[model samples]
Target chain A: MHIAFDPRLRVAGPLQALDARCKVLAFFALVACAASVPAPSWRAPVAFLGAATLLLLVSRIPLGAALRRLLFLVPVVLALAAVVPFAKAAGGEKVALWTGGPMVPRQGLLVLWNVSSKALVGLLCAIILAGTTGVPRLLEAFERLCVPRVLVLTMSFIHRYAITMQEELARMKRARDARGWRGRWIWQAGTLGSMAGTLFLRSYERGERVWQAMLARGYRGKLIGPSSAPLRLLDVMFVVWMLAAGLAIRFLVR
Target chain B: MTAPAIRVSALTFRYPDGTRALDDVSLEVAPGERVALLGANGAGKSTLLLSLNGLCDPGGRVEIGGTPVGSRNLPEIRRRVGLVFQNPDDQLFCPTLFDDVAFGPRNLGLGEEEVQKRVHEALHRVDLATLEEKPSFHLSYGQKKRAALATVLSMQPEVLALDEPTSALHPRARREMIALLRTLSCALVVATHDLEMARELCPRAVVMARGRIVATGETSVVLADTKAMDEAELL
Candidate 1:
């Protein structure tokens, strides 16, 4: 499978130019508020989505790329919410689609709406955050936000090596294919299993070497982050506006 | 006489599986000198290189610029010896080229200004100044290799220990790497199967076999010794 090592677009824009820490805080607030929106609240979720789309536009991220990333989570969310519309809630109106088909409850549909809409808003906010900020700056933002160093370091390594691991697995698959080993049958999965074992072993060995490399370059126990700049007035204003918007959505617009 | 950039005497290492990686390995490289570590696979060249920076659990004396390679002086020793691993992927672990290059300097507790200065200088040295924001995986293999070198060079190590620096490079990239390595004045001990690179970049050569030093002398003279090369399975 083709995977982008980094999903952040190279383009610079207003949203991309914002301090990562502020962007992170604002996005987090927006997502939290979106998640907390009442099940019956359509206006709040729509507003949250509109704001996310606006941010995406301001970032100058191509709509096609953002939509592609957004679509990746849609299927999973739909699958999860799929069952909700079929379940009849207590004392809720149920409508049958067919002669003997499962009844669709009105409350269940609302529940599905709550789940899918909230999830979409959350995912959109995440996509915007990731698309605008590079991984290094995002990690630095997390560090500045008081995230644990070990956790940040683990994320950094995962971001750096996930693609490498994928490429390694792909190469192993190709090597397997080159040896005239096409396993179309269920029994042929044993070869794939062994390949996975080999990949694990290779990754383990590489981890050791990477550790050695880190140590050889004076890596003490601490992982150092990029230098953080002081938050600008614009960053604070943007954050305040976001927080107010989130709180307003939760309390007002009923 | 100036102190050796690296000094190893009677160094030995054994794996947990009872495999000996290095045995009684004694060698030294003077300041500003370049030496090539040549041997076949499993000949302990990489193990020896790791020992220089106290990365290997070894028995015997290993010194970097008169400082012993021990737990106490590990940070200082590591700063003095920059080891570029055989795989660039193993070395460039940070999120971006800039972060990877800045990692060593940051770890040294240098101020941000100094770290940035070193990172810029290191990237410029590797001709990756424009890609400081690019991720390592996005880079071509050759670029990743140079970024890995920049990761170490940012530390400004007095000695550089590179394992297979030109192993997987295309001919042009290899020549570029050779040209780059020639510009450095620090002591260098490169472990590789690339005899041509050794002939071009190093004035001295050390050959290892079965965890032991099989030969050591002037690069041309030692490389010309057919018996030693044959014995080391490097011929």
Candidate 2:
């Protein structure tokens, strides 16, 4: 199965028009604000979700694609949220589990709602940002934002090669299937583990070869790039508007 | 005009698990010589190429321009020898084609203007000038290979070491690569089983098998030696 982020989402057009640093900071700030509000307050989450939806609509990305990406996180959040009510007692006071008592807490449902909504909103913001910006532009933006060069370099390589690794995995799976080695769930797990091991080794070898190639070109442990386009006044204005709207929602709306 | 550009003497190597990869190999190439290393699979051709740039340890018996391969001379040696790996995906690790081509020059601490100049020149050399801003992954295989070549060429190395440079290239792309390599003045060492390519592009040929050099001479004679070619599995 392909695990790579879609490339079509990264093509330059409407999304490329906006500065990457602005989008990253804005998304991050929104996520932090979304996470900080108490779970019991539904109004904050509703406001955050509404803001994210508005941004998505204005960005001109297809609504279906955005929702599809957001949907990927639903199962995980739901699984984590499922156990909340059963784990805690409903009343403020806890009672023995084996004894006859209403052990589940009423606040547990509120906590679950809070966690799920925050996670969904946070994920939505991230998806929108990633969908708009290509990986290289995003890395360049991070570098401009003063992110450590090593981290930027690492993420850049990861984004470039993740698809290659996925292709390698697909090839291995095809080879295994050709050998007629179909099996049950546990056997499949074993096969997957071996595939993971092989992928790791191959990636490690590729890493060495890439480094050697780098050295051949006079690489000295530091990454360098061309002079990027300077942030325009419009990019600054975009950031100001996003921050203002976010702050207005958080502090003023209440 | 001076010493041979590359010198290898009694070069031997073994992997960590003790599998001998190269054995008692000795050779030399003068400046501007285009040499093809012809071998079948598992012939240790790549191992030898890697040794030229200090990517592989040769147990202390390899030299470039009369200077022995060592930690002290490695950076200088690497700057002089551009090694293009078989896979473009592995070689072009940077996110964008521009960054990948500029990587080597940037690492050399060149100014941003110089880096851009080299990147443009290298891309122009490989006929990839229009793809400066494209991501590496989005390019077709032929384009990726050309970009990979540009990545190394930007460094302007005196010696170019290529491993399977045309293995998966289309016919047109292969022709383009051979033409490009011919126009370059640097000493070229290409390791491949493509006898046709060797016949067309290189004046000299080396036959390798099981980590040993079986024959080396004028490309036509060495490649025409049926018995030696058979023994080395090149034929």
- Chain A, model 1: TM: 0.86
User: Candidate 2 lDDT, tens digit per residue, B1-235?
Assistant: 6989899999899988887889999999998999999988888999999999988888648877778888788878887888998988888776568888988887777888998899999999988899887768779998888888898899888889999988998899899889988999999999999898999999999999899999999999998899889989976
Considering the two chains of model 1, state its CAPRI-style docking category: medium
User: Candidate 1, A67: how far from true, in Å?
Assistant: 2.3
Q: Relative to the unseen true structure, what is the C-alpha lDDT of residue B1 in candidate 1, on a scale of 0 to 100?
A: 71
The candidate that achieves the highest TM-score relative to the unseen native structure: 1
Which portions of model 1 miss their true places by more than 4 Å?
A1-8, A86-88, A95-103, A176-188
In candidate 2, which residue ranges exceed 4 Å CA deviation? A1-5, A11-15, A85-89, A92-107, A140-157, A174-197, B1-3, B65-69, B111-117, B130-140, B169-173
Can you write out model 2's per-residue Cα lDDT over A17-99, one digit (the tens) per residue?
87888878877877777787765576777888898888777766667777777778878877976687656653574444456
In model 2, residue pairs whose N, Cα or C atoms come closer than 3 Å (at least 3 residues apart or on different chains), thus clashing, are: A89-A103, A89-A104, A89-A105, A90-A104, A90-A105, A90-A106
Give the whole-model CA lDDT for all candidates, comma-separated: 0.85, 0.80
| Model 2 TM | 0.83
